[model samples]
Target: MCDTTPKTPIWKAIADALRSDLAEGRYTPGDKLPTEAALAERFGVNRHTVRHGISALVEEGLVRTRRGAGAFVAAIPTDYPIGQRVRFHENLIAAGRRPEKQILDVEERAATDGEAKALVINTGDPVCAYHGLSLADGQPIAVFESVFPLSRLAGMASALQDTSSVTEALRALGVNDYTRATTRLTAVRARATHALHLQVSEGDPLLRTSSVNIGEDGQAVEYGRTWFAGDRITLTLES
Candidate 1:
């Protein structure tokens, strides 16, 4: 006897095949997918169906599209721990990925009211602001801005100029260690500036973390904000 059943939709089937290939690591992170026309030929479907299939991957965070370029595999979300000791270099090394920071700018300016409050400094007091992009395996993952009370860490800007590692910079200033004092997490849409720096589309998902780091003296040392590419990094909390 012969059995008959409804066939799976072509677009769904296409997405399934692509998903399987990804699972098998046929395409690595940042690998561009074949053009819609090429995939259409292989699947015997039109470009629209192929696009529909790719769109599903995009929604799943498995793929991303560029305005002028084609679709590409998205990076696997890196597991990031949020705890007392949050060190970027140590965390990425343990995860078997090379971490690097590209310094965007470093400047000394008057602290804004919010910054002053976070660092326990007077409004309009001098603050050294450091902005940079955090990358894993050379892919942009997060944009971070850290503000330090210039009066306390007078050499922060110069130290940052010598090294991209924040931990090292603070160490040069005789800060042996610091720990997270408080953290607030929220979800936000990417702005154009962030999109330009992070290589994500404007309005893409982002995870924002605002936190204060304290020195051994129990004084606020830094007020930092990190905006993570929602699809590229997973923030984990320790119980």
Candidate 2:
């Protein structure tokens, strides 16, 4: 029998008790949790304490509550990192899931001002734009739109359908020599496409990364923007 004793802050103790119960399969994912009043009675705490415990779980992304209904377990989040140059397939494999891609748009067009600056190419330079969603275990996790200099990477658009990996595609194009090169990150709300792909509420927290891959000669080869669901990914950077 598990101890029901409370030894720490009342809220944490309550939260831990609930966490343990959920982990023990007393309640499964998507199971509607007991009401705050009922939980307070079970834990011998006040209603406010039960609310705090549930709030903790919500913050941890363990459970979600629907107004006018009740709280329920949230599906486990998949861990992904942002501060690296690893291919999407590699990252998901490391995290124990099969990776997949849904190509959205793959075509060549003249670079826009932003793409031109990011890739360090002259405005109107031909660029191959590839837009897709990166998925793991069939769940969409990221939306990517990357542009590569068509002048530099001839036939890249054709190459990428077979290999969406920026690194691998670059290698096949004789531009194998590239570096993490440059990266800028910001917290954003999941915009139109990302919101749809990630299935999160519009404006949910997101990790937005803009990166440019450059060759050894200081030439930018690719510029990409990626949005990762905050709940599904963790970004780690080490020196």
Candidate 3:
């Protein structure tokens, strides 16, 4: 017999199922989740309740929904050692996944006030801006815009190739020495460009991170804005 004693709240029950799956590694990072109907059937709930549960995960940066595609589990965000430096490509590869990039724009542009301040350069200073989607297994993971001072990265714009990570591009410019970074993170809705690049629904939740990289001499080397698909990535820090 079905123990249908009007059990737990449907939404909370669904959330618990997802949370348990995540903790047990049943739903690994970067994996697409079942459709709402499927989850509803699996949990004996209505689609609306499944949606409510999904929204809760989105608010926590644990999952995201695509316009036509459906839900997906967030990927694991690599954490560089507090004092160690690593490239995004290298980090993803170490996690046993192939890293790729889709270049949206690469050009030398005058820094905006915010960009200039974040990079500690004068407003209107020349900054090489690299904008693109970083992917794992051809699925959009993070949308990024990396800005570096032109004075420190001469000819970098011209040297970058499609699908090249910023670290590789910097190395090509002969500026390999870099220390770790300080990062700040929060949950946010996807902006127009960010949603388009990540292929997620408009207003879908994302993990917004701002990072400033410093050099061995303690000079700011680069500043970046990264928007990660909330369901497709998780940020982890290690001591």
Candidate 4:
């Protein structure tokens, strides 16, 4: 007697099937998936098997589990460009998302060693620092701290108070335009404060960007550090 049968785990098979459905647009981004009971009945499997399948999807970032609400398809990441003319509002608008910013703190601060080097000012020089949270479609996406040399942009703090945009504030201060001079990126785990602002669990992934902006005359105008939710935004580098 010759007997040959294919051996594959049922859970993996279910996962594959669900992945296919996702690829075929059966479940679009942000769509709620069927309940475990429904999937178990449909697949003629136990709830545990269905749960295992969903767990695979979650690991793949194709689905997100909500407490007491089952699972839902994850949102497509917004394409954010890091370019010479990086504008947060413009970037989110181009990605078809509504952009919003909340200014958390604005005050005069003495420049630290790093800020002094970036801003071409002496250590302890007066600098205007702006701290804010950026959101896309009402979901917090990043937190930013931007420092400006107050000697050059003396009214920057007042300008920022009237607007939620750094670009606008700089423009109000007579800096018609600025270009990204340098950017250094690093991957880090979200700390407690970062997690609270981004609405993610502690130790979740985050992208930290440290950058400097230069004005038309090639003077460093702004030094900024931003922490972005790794799952929400996809950083794209431009030439």
List ranges where model 2 is wrong by over 4 Å.
1-60, 64-84
Alpha carbon lDDT at 61, candidate 3: 72
Residue 28 local lDDT, model 1: 91
Candidate 4's error at 216, in angstroms?
Answer: 1.2
lDDT of 3: 0.79
Over the stretch 12-77, how does candidate 2's per-residue lDDT look in tens digits?
Answer: 988899899998999875568999989999989899989999999999989876554678777556
Clashes of each: 0, 0, 8, 0
Q: How accurate is candidate 4 locally (lDDT)?
A: 0.91
The better candidate by lDDT, 1 or 2, is 1
Flag regions of model 1 displaced more than 4 Å.
Answer: 1-13, 37-45
* lDDT (CA) per prediction: 0.94, 0.81, 0.79, 0.91
Candidate 1 local lDDT, residue 127? 96
Over 104-220, each residue of candidate 1 has an lDDT whose tens digit, in order, gives 999999999999999999999999999999999999999999999988999899999999888999999999999999999999999999999888888989999999999999999
lDDT rank order = 1, 4, 2, 3
Candidate 2 has what TM-score? 0.71
| Clashing pairs in model 2, backbone N/Cα/C closer than 3 A | none
Ten-residue stretch with the least lDDT total in model 2: 75-84
Candidate maximizing TM-score? 1
Q: Is candidate 1 or candidate 4 better by TM-score?
A: 1
Give RMSD (Å) of candidate 3 vs. truth. Answer: 5.3
Alpha carbon lDDT at 109, candidate 1: 95
Greater-TM-score candidate between 1 and 2:
1
